[model samples]
Target: MSSAAPLLLSPKEVNLLKQSPTPISILDATWFMPNVARNATDEFLSKRIPGAQFLDLDDVASPHELGLKHMMPDQKKFSQACERLGVTPSSHVVLYDTHSVFSSPRALFMFRSFGHQNSSVINGGLPRWVHEGLPIERNSPSMIPSSHYEPPHFDARLIRDYQQIVENSKLDPQTNPDAEIVLDARAHGRYLGAVPEPRPELSSGHIPNSFSLPFNLFLQKQGTPDGEYTTFLPEQELRAALDNVVGAQYAEKIISGERPVVTSCGSGMTAGVLWLGLSLLGAKNIGLYDESWTGYAMRPSSKIVKTA
Candidate 1:
């Protein structure tokens, strides 16, 4: 297995690393849907993993010039944010959240997008660590002075704007046969228009010809109260789940970078979870639709598909 295949670390692995001489930057990237009332920053201030800093997704994102939420910022902005968070180019970042795998993958995506490749998402997040009796600290760690961190030119290979997605959807698969595969990470009900979207004025459905692969399917319950801590499914199960949507043959090709894969969701957050899953499987030609359904559904001219 490639060193990266284990993309996740067990609570024990994290505990053991805490005692090691090597330095690792741990981030609490906890976030919640707008409908969810909890404030992640306040929660982090109350309790968090020792030596962990909070990475506020909403705070570090693009300034929403296009009216989209949490879009990736420019290279300079991202570099400045990393420096503020004490993330050096050599920092080995490990992200975790209160709600299992939900928002950590988005943080991982941000790190990778900003040319920070040495990063991973903690498998089951803070809830799991607490369940396992790992050490927790209430006091916030003092911020290390801003380090000179520089990122390479911003990479657009893993990103897709609304225009690209609109154009790709219009392509005839037979003529433009290699068009990117569009995958939506929303729930089946929302993807099928059977359930109302949490965001007002947005239609409930998916992009035309897009595959519905709910982000939750990639996770398995960790037996926590209220099922708070979920973990990524085993490799075998993950492969099977992915195969169901993209086909086993195509899934292999996608993982090997022979085919293009694009992931999206409500506001581009859970889409990152899908991106992370594909990355763990060694996929290189992956792209994230940053505007996602929030932009797509609101557009009067965009095509939508509600049926499987």
Candidate 2:
């Protein structure tokens, strides 16, 4: 909790700060899967944390100009959106979602990319909070009046374009070596081409030379059967899980800002979860492949590996 980097806050930790004089902004950034019919806005309107604002990921954080889903917006657009949400530069933002650890991490990563250093994600999101008997509001909270928000120079190092990914995919540690490590956060079945992709046009498989480390591995089920919620593991367990993929020494290098980590997923959404995990460990050189497999699969020249 005392670390300089962003950390996940427990429900109890959030409750203790209910009376703190510092400005804390809560954001409900719930985003459902494509097949799910539930509307996040309607859910937020029905019930949400007290004083929480709704951030529509598809609307507020996406770049419509690129014709892609949930792409990061430019600095000016992101600044304007944050201003409309009444998020000042000094605000300590806390994001949560209905689906536990799914969508909130994306919002956290977005905030960090925009140079907001004080952002964090609730460990188990709304479900855990409700399960813990914390207070909730039925009516939609009134939005604070707009404020001015100016972001620092946008950092391109936090993002990896398709060309960069393609180039990285070709590097072989056995022969040509590089400091960059590419991680894929998709299911093992999807990564091995044993399961079909959600998108029909995109083929199932993974980027060449990328290691598989599904994002859900970091999450553990909490709460009772009636209201089960997913939350991140304890620091020791989380570190062990990460060390399994990148080895303990390399993981330490990543945490100490010595090596670069690049994360990718089906369409770039779950990649945020991996980015968040690295960020929690204080990894400074983190990058996300914005287009992910959706873009890579469509390119005939891109290298893809399938176990089956």
- Best model per lDDT: 1
lDDT of 2 by residue, 1-308 (tens): 11233568877787776568877788899998776789999999999989889988888655533366778877887888888888888888889999989989988888878778788899899998998889999975886999888755677788899888888878863345474788889898999988988877678998888888999987898759676999887777878888998789878877887767899998788899898887767678889998788878888887778997
Task: Show pairs that collide, candidate 1.
Answer: none
Worst 10 residues of 2 by lDDT: 1-10
Model 1 root-mean-square deviation: 2.6
Per-model RMSD to reference: 2.6, 2.4
The Cα error of candidate 2 at residue 112, in Å, is 1.1
The digit string of per-residue lDDT tens for model 1 on 1-308 reads 00232467887897887688745788999989989999998999999998888898887878764577688888887878778888777777889999878999998888877667777788989888898888999886766777777755677888898889988887654346578888899999999998989997788987876788999888888686545679888877888889998788778888888779899999999999999888777788999999899988888888887773
The alpha-carbon root-mean-square deviation between model 2 and the true structure, to one decimal in Å, is: 2.4
